[model samples]
Target: MTDPTPLTSLSSALADVVARAAPSVVSVHSHRARSTGFVWKSGLIITADEALADEGEVRIGLPDGSTVAATVAGRDHTTDIALLRADTSIAPVRLTRTVPALGALSVVVATTRDAPSAALGMVSVSGQGWRSLRGGEIDARIELDVRLRSSQEGGLALEASGEAFGMAVLGPRRVLVIPTATIERVAAQLETRGRIARGYLGLGLQPLRLDDGIGAMVMNVDKAGPAAAAGIRQGDVIVAVNDQKLSGVRALLRTLGPASVGRVVDVAVRRGGEPTSFRVTIGERPEA
Candidate 1:
């Protein structure tokens, strides 16, 4: 028979992985939301935005049974990543850009309420980049076969080699990893600017049918916005942007992502049956 010691050693190694990562794994408490977060930097914590309460005092419970008050540094709902600022000295997690392979043995180091927790599973699906329903840009689509609790939403996903790769959050039917690349990208901007800006045209549009293609009727325009500066009126019907068909309001929004900010696009509109073209510089969407 094959030696059973190998199995025992493997079990001990898995537990060691969790133990090594537990100090940085914190139990997050914000209003009524009880979830997990990991220290991203010396004084910053990253957690799942969907699991964080919108407005409340944020706090994190440390491994040594200590708690510290935190404040919302920034939050991006589109990607379900939120950053918090606190006075903590727990060692920050060393994140890797490595994408796990399918069927790779994985462990999720998280916390339940005020205590640390761990779950073992496999990388069920690993694919290329994907866009979220809210138009957020996710670097990779990595799913796990692990069963995680509601309080373990923002745990760290690690490989058997003890490589901390990404943050695990509960997705629709499975746990998804917010890859290290995406987290590093968004967290840097949030840490510096307090928010990630998206492009905006400042026009409230409704679908309008035209003879040749789809158009959007501008129901409202911000008087102080770029559209207004470009001579676009509320009743103007926008036919195309940069020669692309305006199929729907969502289509228009899709064009106004992060890269669109500061970009100038030719907006073709119809005013009183007269076609008009204007070069308008897209502006950053104002914070709500």
Candidate 2:
């Protein structure tokens, strides 16, 4: 008969991790919708912004079966993270800065109606850094091989050691783990300013090949946009931004981060077989 010790030990270890992380997990209720959130700090909770409705009041259900009223301290739609402040206190989960290895054991701890529940999975994808489809800069890309319910969107992604790798959110088609570095960075800014500022160029572009290499082909220009004001027109191939060679749409979007707003930068483009440069000022993206 095969030894059962290994399987028994693995089950016990996972139970211990869930026990340690359960106190930090809470059910967040906003405008009749329910989701999960983890205590980021004393009186502070972090949740998925997309799960939150544009309502006035938010409530947090604690492990002790009591609920506390919470206020929306800040939110960043770009990163899909929201910060909530409450009067109650709970032990915050320990966030690990180290990235988890691919195929490593990971757990998703979520709050159910009565108690905290856990789901088992493994790290399926890991990368250094990347941008989201909406142009948000993610410090590290981590994806899990688990299917999560809508209520588990803002739950914790914990390593086998019980250290939090990040917060789990439902992506376009799969589950995405927002790394700890990104959570900390965005949370700090949101806690301070209540919103993240993003730079906008106001030009629709498509990836196209130029004589030198790959470039972004401008498809449409906003008449009142900074790009239009700087003489950027349709059919122009943008090859470089601030002297950095552009390879695709991702590179251009990555370059236009929050800091690029209002900054004047040189854009190199190929027009009629000759390289031309245009000085354009970045603008703020209009709120949706």
lDDT digits (tens) for residues 160-186 of candidate 2:
999998999999888999899999999
Worst 10 residues of 1 by lDDT: 249-258
What ranges in model 1 sit over 4 Å off? Answer: 1-4
TM-score of each: 0.95, 0.80
User: Judged by lDDT, which candidate is best?
Assistant: 1
Q: After superposition, which runs of candidate 2 have C-alpha atoms over 4 Å from their true positions?
A: 1-4, 202-240, 243-254, 268-276, 281-288
Give the worst 10-residue stretch by lDDT in candidate 2. 250-259
How much is 99 displaced in model 1, in angstroms? Answer: 1.3
